[model samples]
Target: MKNVTIYTGPLCNFCDAAKRLLARNNVEYKEINIATVDGAMDEMITKANGKRTIPQIFFDDNHIGGYDDVRALEKENKLLELLK
Candidate 1:
């Protein structure tokens, strides 16, 4: 499986939702809390192409965007393939 990373912040519903979705699929991920990690917020913004949102996810080196974007991939049946 590809390495999954999620950039998140405190009190974010989208982040929780995204995590639940991944858990349901048995996907393991590294979670980076921007509120607690130094310079993580800036790294997330850069990786997300300037989108300043919580739950910016990446599958390996490829950016999968936020919760809605990742959910869209799941809805379209492409998320698992991407992970593979």
Candidate 2:
């Protein structure tokens, strides 16, 4: 399976929703709390191709963008392929 990592901030509804979707799909992921980590937001942005948003998702070191992007992938039935 691909290594999924999510960069999120505290109390973010989108982040929580994204995590819930992943959980429902039984997707394993690493959650990084950018709120408490210095420089983590910057790193997330850099890795996400300048997307300065919370809940930046990565699939096996590949930036997959934010919650909407993830949901779109799921809608298109592409998320599971990436998970593998």
Candidate 3:
């Protein structure tokens, strides 16, 4: 499986949902809480291409955006391919 990373914050339902989706798919991920870490939000923004949002996800080096974006990828049957 490819390495996954999620830049998240507390009290974010989207983040939780994204995590659940990844869990259901058995995609292990590294969760980075920006609220708890200094400079993390800046990194997330940079990685997300200036989209400052919670739950920014990455599969290997691919920025997968937020929960809705993730679900869309799964619906399109591309997520599994990325995981591989």
Candidate 4:
């Protein structure tokens, strides 16, 4: 499986939902909490191409976007392919 990363923040329902989706798919991920981690917010913004949002997801170094984006990919049955 490819490495997964998620840039998230506290009290974010979207982040929780995104995590749940990953869990359901049996995908392990590294969670970076911007609210508590120093410089995480700036890092997430840079990696997310200026999209300052919680649950910014990535597969390896490829940006997979936010929760809605990943959910859409799942719906299209493309997420697993990307993981591989």
Candidate 5:
């Protein structure tokens, strides 16, 4: 399986949804809640190409973006492929 990392924030519905999607797929992920960690947002922005949104998901080196993006991958039947 690939390394799954997600930058999230508290109270973000999309973040919850993104995490649920991964969990539903049995994908192990590292969740970085920016709201609880200082400078995490900055790190997320730098890593995500300045995207300030919550649930910035990454699989290995591939940036999978937000909730919709991850769902798109699932819809296209590519999400599990990435997990492998």
Candidate 6:
């Protein structure tokens, strides 16, 4: 199984949407709330290669961008392959 990590902030609609999408696909993920954790934003930026955005997702260390990227993967029928 792929190890999925989501860097998020509280009250972020995109984050919530991303979580829901993952849940619907039965993909388990770790959620890191950057808003409440010090240094979390920096970590996310580093992982994302300087994309300062909420809902930075990593699948087994593979950067997956944000919610839109996730949805695009799903739309293209590539999400399940990555999840595996």
TM-scores of the candidates in the order shown: 0.96, 0.94, 0.94, 0.97, 0.95, 0.96
Candidate 4 residue lDDT tens string, 30-68: 999999999999998999899997889999999989999
Q: Write the per-residue lDDT of candidate 5 for residues 10-69, one digit (tens) a residue.
A: 899999999999899999999999989889999889989989999899988778799999
lDDT (C-alpha, whole model) for all candidates: 0.94, 0.93, 0.92, 0.95, 0.91, 0.95
Score candidate 4 by lDDT.
0.95
lDDT of 3 at 33: 99
Q: Candidate 6: what lDDT?
A: 0.95
Q: After superposing candidate 2, which stretches have Cα over 4 Å from the reference?
A: none
Runs with alpha carbons beyond 4 Å of true place in candidate 5 = none
Tens-place lDDT per residue, model 6, 1-84, is 899999999889999999999999999999999988899999999989999999999998999999999999999999999787
What lDDT tens digits, residue by residue, belong to model 1 across residues 4-78? 999999999999999999999889999999999999999999888998988999999889899999899889998
Q: Give the better candidate number (4 or 5) by lDDT.
A: 4
Q: In candidate 1, list every pair of residues with a backbone clash.
A: none
- Per-residue lDDT, model 6, residue 11, is 87
Worst 10 residues of 5 by lDDT: 55-64
**lDDT for position 64 in model 2:** 90
> Per-residue lDDT for 3-67 in model 2, tens only?
99999999899999999989988999999999898999899988988998889999988999889
Give the Cα error of residue 25 in candidate 1, in Å. 0.5
Q: What RMSD, rounded to one decimal, does every model reach?
A: 0.7, 0.8, 0.9, 0.6, 0.8, 0.7
Query: Model 6: what TM-score?
Result: 0.96
Give the lowest summed-lDDT range of ten residues in model 1. Answer: 45-54
